[model samples]
Target: MNTSELDLRELLSFKPRGGAISFLGQRMYLTDLFSHGLQQMELCRTLGPEITQSIIVRAGFSKGWLVAERIKRQMPDAWAEARKGKLGPLLCSMYGFGEVLSSQRRDGIQATPLVETYFISLYEAEQHLRMHGLSNVPVCWEQIGFASGYVSNLEGRTVYFIEDECQAKGDSYCHLRGNYLEKWGAEITPYLPVYSGICNETVAAQLADVLRSDEALPRNMQDKINLSLKLTSIEDGYPVSNSYAMRSLLEMAINVAKVPTSVLITGESGVGKEKLVQYIHKNSPRSDKPLVAINCGALNETLLENELFGHVRGAFTGADCSKSGLIEAADGGTLFLDEVAELSPATQVKLLRVLQEKEVRRLGDTETNHVDVRIISATNKSLEAAVEAGEFRQDLYYRLKVIELNIPPLRERTEDILPLSRYFLMKFNQELGKNHTGFHYKTADLLLSHNWPGNVRELVNAIERAVVLSAGPQIMPEDLPHEIRDTLCLPSVAGDIRALHEVEKDYILAVLEKLDNNKTQAAEKLGMSLATLYRKLKEYGALQIAICSWLYSIAAILPGV
Candidate 1:
């Protein structure tokens, strides 16, 4: 069949029971586009870009070569059409690689025809852009290899396709030019090893061996991979811990869970006080019982009273029926009062009475009901400060803080950043149907560097947003929220204010380091002249003798000197 007559849909088939899918009578299965990107990312990360490119190119060559052979065997007429430079682009487009915008051949130029093909919306380039951002060179390695393989098989001579322009490098489109290897000469030497070296099978086997043996990887990388797996395996709805502080806090929580005394959790807002409460409740003596929770700050005085101590029928104008309060509903379980500091003085008295008497008296009801419930109060504000200010009762503060547990803010537990990020990545991946493998290295750096002013809740929102925006196998820095991506990696001088000169010296050195010690660039960025920067560095005793000598020579040549 001619290329124009081929029907792509008719050549593929699948069974409803899901045994196997067939494409052109060959067994095939669909794969997520991001899966290939993930493999590329991991291979590049572990093996370096050069080797990974070679492997991917060779694999694509093998695939294209096999497909050419299949076409020759199944339809000899189509093979003739392919030899005319008509079928390759059609096949490529039909297989969903991309749309070939144009294809042209000049047969009279040489013994072998010279072919030029321009493709838009190439999946390879899109994948590269998504995974690694813009690259410095052409990144459509597989597409080049495929074209070379297909053309070489058809012409019975070695042919090479060089991608002169690629979208991966921020080009408008990918442009491939193909000709005999001898015609390109030295231009193709760098890629010759990819085609002439060990066969694709050997490379595949070696890669498989390397991947199967954890000993082959560096120790730190192995640890990172193991940590990732461990994070992924954690059960959902449980608090994730990586920092020693958080782990120790969890141990404390578990120890305190066995006790039935009232516990107060203290932390900044969004520091996961509720999660700590859930952890305590799950591990407590009343594990099978209900865990009722309420945000006292969400309700005013009367509503808070009604919610805390259920109102009987005709208790108020809106109270048409009697309803159980959170304390009564949490009988034989735990009651979590979030933002307990927001409770009014009257509600605090009633809650203090409930704690002291172990009985809750519903509104407008004479008889009280005895309830057995553990009180777990949480407040972002300092109850001590509030009690001192007379805004809160001292007795109620002491009653709620029988055994206080304080959770450190996320910034203080920096080690938990990646673990929590991975946890949320896995969570949102499942929730959003994404296949993101992990964060890009730069993205991880940004996440670690962020102050996390909003704590874990901010991190959760960031990860969920990244998962929604990321188009690659890994999350990139651009996918992160702007505030996070823009977080400066400055040395924190939170409490101790240093002298102005010391701060200036640190900032200058930091800029120099960030620019890889390029003093000129650092000076430009620091908004100072080279001589001025040199003088500052010399004053700080930071200039090496070689730099000092160079500066002296430059000074000698200047008019001012």
Candidate 2:
């Protein structure tokens, strides 16, 4: 029961029956740190930082209290040992919060002692760096709350911890100074309500209600839809996706990542092909190695060749020194060939040789160097069409297309539009220092209705522009670009307005077609019962056609439909 003898294995237990994990005999679950950070960012976007911080802090406080109470009941000696100030930091490190570098107690003006602790390599700060980049304010709210709760319970009085310096705000280490309530009066008054718990409970209840409301996506669907891809750039991490299409695409990409085969990603420009490539590389075995990317379309034949195949000294005019190509640099890792379809025939031949032989020969050099790398190429253009047109090498096309991942356009995945918009809104709000709550209802309608020809990139630009130009608390219609705003203002041809039922029929049919005549899924997405969808289709004189299409689709899969 001694704190020094505590082991993590003894404190943690797993029960596979219900897929439950327990820490200190209390239910616990593991989660990805990056995903946790994205959730925190989302909470901040919806509830504002103050409320989100309160919620996280209160949750941490509750956890700390539970742990303390459990230890006091199971190991009274350990509870007594905690009063000497050795147990809290040891337990914190044991629980993977961070490593405590130093801890000390100092005499204060009041009767209560002041506890000062310094921690390094905390997970919260690391997650912030990965997701939101550098923050201006301290962001260890949960750790601060946990320390306060643990210490307060030991002290048998209200104690609070103030984060004097935090790694999230670019501090070298996190410094937490704690003391009894009266000892640090006035400076801690504003945060006292959070520790008092009543106000935060109300805010958390309101948040729960909002999450469970009819306007929100179903809880199970939300879990399935909340997918993210961590990126190299701190500011540009993942596009939040709510579409089944994107989810299935990502699942395929992950499965394809297990091997070292060449992959070709095809999609419209700005559809996040590069992001998908990054996701694959990150999940691959060579994740710890470099991921070097080059745009074949950005460079001419000569430059692209030199970039991909490097050169020896004096290989060309002004070539003073030998250099390794991106392919060479990416040895034991991944080389991302963006816009691979734009590679000239000569460059394509050279790239094909590299893929086939796993070696790259420098320009003006007879010898070739071996490279162990995975090739992940992306293109907005169709390589198959290019091969048919004799604009690209057929052999190279086959080599690159060992596995293909095609991202659907934004217009085709309407379910993800609003989620992506809100994600971009949150991102730019931090970058632009704005406090826009969300899109106006009318503005949201305009966004969902637009075709988004430029795809995800266009949405990012639009949201950034709206965040900058928005004058009200929420993004209004006027804040959007002219093209997006004019969507609602466009006039019908001949000034003829269609009947509401006719328009509804057209929309329902469009949804069914988009889903490949999958009526069950279409109904779920459209928020209608299957029976009601059938009735509507019958009224529109399309029920028989829908049934035939469904049967045809089934016939293509099964031996008999």
Candidate 3:
């Protein structure tokens, strides 16, 4: 029976496991993503297959119904991705947040009093999820995109299409053996309500079309990328991916608290090199004493020395009062020199004397003062290169590199993007009193795809900008600044083509594997012309392998198949 054109009121015989649940007027579901076969494998396979489930769940995104508003209002505390698309059972492991809605019926009549999206509470959402007793997608972002999508409004509608496809799977065999595809199962989820009433099918479809449009490129350009930013561990509330490394470095600094060795922290300009310096000071034994910090690159020789060491009365023109330098203030504590590489020769000599003699002679004074202080310096440049080029002193370079730590760029730690994104979201929301729940799923992908040249600093600035600009419960793609907007559309900027190709390849392979080698779906997702995809597949000789892999996987995961 062709149910597509019939009014839902005429035939209400459909029965999916978790009957249609909705929030407001948006329609969506909670799919039993894990068929009986996969459950058996997960229970039985040890290292046998950790990647399979992640792959299966990821296939949910290929056909999702994403609605930008309701998903945001319903799960204000959820990840941004969820707000835009209605995905399958959210893989919390890598779940970015979202809600699902589906139409429900109690009688034989298929027509509803009216199609509606239903509001669900946080507690109820939690309870409903708990009762399912199913695992979420893998924690990794790559895995989440594969395991299951954070489906929302339009994304949910797409999934219904997928459901249609899945139910139709056996139809092909019907021609040969007269066997029909069985209705495996189905489900429904809740949606959030908006003041302007529910999003109609037409508008929802239009929105989806826009989201998939290439014009979204203003947010994806490469040249406009900033190159400085620290990989911050915590800002608003989200934890960055390299939290472990940053923490380990802090612990190392603490371990050497008693030693007076100079510590050099190298990273991009805005990568929080200075912040890490502070972390070292706070963790060191000199925590009780004053800690002074100066940017060596920001001042001239005479001013720099006077800034680091005290000046005698009438020593210089601005010697209005005999004043103590930052060094004097941090007596018995620690002195942090930022951009230490920028220090001129004259300033370098004075700093070297302070470190070596543990004494300082105030300007124009014959007498010298003895002091004890630890020195912690930071620089974003390559000190070794500077030393070789005769720009920085050999002695100072030797001293600083004694204990060096290098901070990895954000692109190097893609796993952390979502976590840090959320951290910023929660923080800005609380600080500004906005009720933004999180990003749209596409936003998460956008962040991952971006080349954060400015590092951790850039993320903070972007989040702050987005927070101030947004007035709604969710941060839409438009909420992001032009830089991030361009990032999603442009090709990878931070890395070379090789890396980009690898990432793209992995994404395609993972999706294909998840869809059980469904060529049509895979082709749609590869964002390629079918001929191009087929030619490339033929060139790589991946066509046969992909099909074989998919069949084997399905045979292994499906029960009694």
lDDT of each: 0.76, 0.75, 0.51
Worst 10 residues of 1 by lDDT: 218-227
TM-score for each of the candidates = 0.52, 0.48, 0.52
Tens-place lDDT digits, model 2, residues 489-554: 221111234466755765676577546578899999899999999999889656765565555556
| The best candidate in terms of TM-score | 1
Query: Which 10-residue window in model 3 sums to the lowest lDDT?
Result: 172-181
Tens-digit lDDT string for candidate 1 (1-561): 334434443344444345565555455777865998998888989999888888877777766666775675444435656656778988888677889999987762575438899999899899888878998899888888888777767766667777889998989989998887767767778877766553334433444433323222221210011112333534234656867788888888889999899999999989999998998999888989999999999988988888889989999897889998989999999999999999998899999988999999999999999999999999999999999999999998888888999999999987677778877887887788766666544466578779999999999999999989876555767799999976644533433354677557656865765564688998888899999998987886557633544465578789978
- In lDDT terms, how accurate is model 1? 0.76
| Candidate 1 local Cα displacement, residue 43, angstroms | 25
Clashes of each: 0, 0, 78
Clashing pairs in 2: none
Where in model 3 is the C-alpha error above 4 Å?
A: 1-251, 257-259, 489-561
TM-score order, best first, reads 1, 3, 2
Model 1, stretches more than 4 Å misplaced?
1-237, 490-527, 530-561
* Residue runs of model 2 more than 4 Å from their true location after superposition: 1-237, 489-561
